[model samples]
Target: MLNSINTNPGALLALQNLNATNTELTTTQSRINTGKKIANAKDNGAIWSMAKMQSASSSSLNAVKDSLQRGQSTIDVALAAGDTITDLLMKMKEKALAASDTSLNSTSLKALKADFDSLRDQITKAAENAKFNGVSLVAGSAKPLVFLANADGGNFTVNAQTLGLQGLGLSTTGTTFTTAAEAGSMISKMTAALLTATNKLSALGTASTGLDTHLTFIGKLQDSLDAGVGNLVDADLAKESAKLQSLQTKQQLGVQALSIANQSPQSILSLFKG
Candidate 1:
C-alpha cells in the first residue's frame, strides 16, 4: 500500500524544534527583564514567604528602636534638670549659713534672706517645669514609664521615685524668723531636703543607665533584623552577574537553533528536485 501524501519529515521536525527554541527564548527574556528568578509566588513559595517575614521583622524592629531612642532623650533631660535643682539647693544652703552670722548687719541678713527665697522659688519652678516630650518626670506628676523586652514580659520598668521633700517647711515666705538662731534652726529642717534631693539624683542616674543598657540591646536586635532582611531580598551582584551571563549565552544559542530550524524546510526542495 503505497500512499501518495506529501508530508516532509524535516518540516515537522523543524516546527517542533522551532517551538522549543521559542519557549527557551521567552524564558530567558523574562528572567532578564525582571531581574528576578522568583518574581512571583508560584516561582518559589518558600523563599517568598521567608522574604516577607524578614521584611516585616525589620520594620517592627526599626519602630522599636525609634521608640527607645526617644525614651533615652526624655530620661536625659529629666536627669539634667534634677541635678541642676540639687546644685541650686546647695547654693541656698551656703547663703543661709551667711545669714545666720551675728556680725552681719540686719540689712545684709535681710538681703541674704531675699536671695535665698528667690533660689528656693527657682528650684520649685524647675521641678514643676521639668518635662520631656510633654511628659513630666519631676513634681510628682508623671506615671512610671515601663519598657518590656519580649512578648512574655519580665523586663525592666523604671519608677519615678519621690525625693521625700513633703515636710521640709521650705517655702518662699509667710513664716517669720525671730533671730539668727531661729533662722539657723531652719537649716536642720532643710538638711533632710538636700539629702533627699541628692539621693533622687543618684536614683535617676541609675535608672538612666538601665535605660541605656536596654536600648543597646534593642539596637543589636535591630541590626540582626536588618541583616536578615538583606539576606532575604537584597540582590547578590556576584550571583546575578553569573546568571545574567548564562542567560545571555542561552539566548544566543536559542537564536542560532531557531535559524537552523527555519532553514530545515529548504532541505525539502532538494528532495523535490531529485
Candidate 2:
C-alpha cells in the first residue's frame, strides 16, 4: 500500500471499523441497563409500536379490574343482606305459625306477634343497609349495578332486587293477631313472604358467583396480555450478557488495529534514514 503522511487510508479504515464497534457496544450496554431490547421507537419501530399498544391495553385492564372488584364487593354486600332477610323471614314464619294455633292464649299470641313484628322490621333494615359505595341492590333501588367486563367497553350487569316489605308482598301494616281468626290469616302471608325473600336471596347469590368468576377471568386476561408484551420487547439477559462480552472484546481489538495503522507512517521515515 502507498503510504502518505498527510492522508493514511489504513488509519481511516481502522477508525471507521472502531467507530462501528463502539456503536454496537453502546447498543449492547443499553440493552443490559434497561433489560429491554426495544426500549424506544429507535430500537425497532414496528415492534416497539406494537408493544406500546399492548402495554396500553394491559394498563387499561387495571381500571377494568378495579371496576369489577367494586361490583363484586357490592354484590357481596347484597348477598349478605339477602341471606339475613331470608333468615328473618323464616323466623317470622315460625312466629306466625305459632300464633295461628287456636289453643294459644291471648298472652302467648301477643308474644308471638311482637316477635314477628320485630323480625319483619329487621328484614327492612337489612335490605336498606345492604350497600357498598352508596349502591344498594335490595333497598328498592331501580338502577342496575354495572361493571366493566373487558378492554373493549363491555359491561356486566346485576339487576337490582327490591327486598323491602312491600316488594316481598308483605303487608306494610303489621299483621293483626288479636284473635284466633286474625292470627290464622297471617300464616299464609308469612309463608308467601318467606318464599319471596328466599327467591331474592337465590338471585343475589347467583350474581355474586358470576362476579367472582368474571373477576378471575379478568385477572388471567391481564396476565396473558402482559406476557404478550414481554415476548415482543423484553430482552434475554443471558443473550445480551454474552453479546456484551463479545462486543467489548471486539472494541479492544478495533482500538489496537487503529493504533497500529496510525504508526504505519513511521515506517516511511525509517526508509529515508541516512
Candidate 3:
C-alpha cells in the first residue's frame, strides 16, 4: 500500500470487479425475463444455431402431419362409400335370387327388376359423391393422392388407394337378367363380384390402418424432438431464481467494496488536517 493521492490501485481493482459483477447480473436478468438460456446468438452462437435447426425440423414434420391428415380424410370418405356400396351389393344379390324363382308372377318379377335397377343407380351415385377436397378416390379417377412421410420430402411418399365399384367387377347395369336360365347364370357372376368387392374392401381397410399406425408414430416422434430442442435451449427457472438472489447480494457487496476503496484516498487528507 502506498500513501499517495495520485493513484489508487485498490480503487481501480474494485471498479473492475464491480463492472464484472454488473455484467453477470445483466445476463442473469435476461435469462429470468426471457426464460431462455440461449435467447440469441449473443448468448451462445453454437447453441443458438443448433436450436434453430431443430426448430426448423419440427416445423417440417408438422407439415407432414398436415398432409397425412388430409389423406386420412380422403381415405375415410372412400371407405364410407365402399361400405354403402357393399350394402347395396347385398340387396342386389337378394333381388337376383328372387328373380331366379321360376314360379314368380310376372308382376312380382317386374317389381324386383325395378328395385334392382334403382339400387344400381344408387351405387353409381355413391361412388360419384365419395369425394374430398376435389379428390375422388372411388370415382375411377387417375388422380393419385400422395402424402409426405418425412421432412425433406425427397424419398418419402405414400400413395393413397382409389376405389371404384364398376372397376371391381361389380355390374352397374340391372338389365343382365331376362329369363329364369339367365337369372341363374347371374348368380355365379354376382357371387364373384361380391367376393372381389369384399377383397377390395379388406385391402382398403389395411391401407387405412397403416396410415393410422404411422400417424401415431409421427406424433410420438414429434414430441420427442420437441423435448430435445427444449433441453438445448430452455432455462432452468429454479436455478435462475437462486442465482438472482446471490447476484443481488454480491452486487451490493461490490458497491460497498468500491466505496471503501475510494475512502483510502481520503486518508491522505488526515495527514494534512492539522
lDDT of each: 0.65, 0.86, 0.79
Instruction: Report clash pairs, candidate 3.
Output: none
lDDT of 2 at 174: 61
lDDT of 2 by residue, 113-141 (tens): 88878887887788888889989888965
> How does model 1 score by TM-score?
0.79
Ranking by TM-score: 2, 3, 1
Order of quality (lDDT): 2, 3, 1
* Candidate 1 C-alpha lDDT tens digits along 122-209: 7767776777778656664656776555323435566674431342345556322535776686566567678877777777788888
User: Distance (Å) between predicted and true CA of 131, model 2?
Assistant: 0.8
> Model 3 reaches what TM-score against the true structure?
0.94
Q: Candidate 3, which segments miss by more than 4 Å at Cα?
A: 154-165, 171-175
Give the worst 10-residue stretch by lDDT in candidate 1. Answer: 161-170
For model 3, residues 182-260, the per-residue Cα lDDT tens digits are 6667667667766776776776677678878877788888888889889998999999999989989989999999999
Best by lDDT: 2
Candidate 2's error at 150, in angstroms?
1.4
**Each model's TM-score?**
0.79, 0.96, 0.94
| Alpha carbon deviation, residue 212, candidate 3 (Å) | 1.0
Better of 2 and 3 by lDDT: 2
The all-Cα superposition gives candidate 3 an RMSD in Å to the true structure of: 1.8
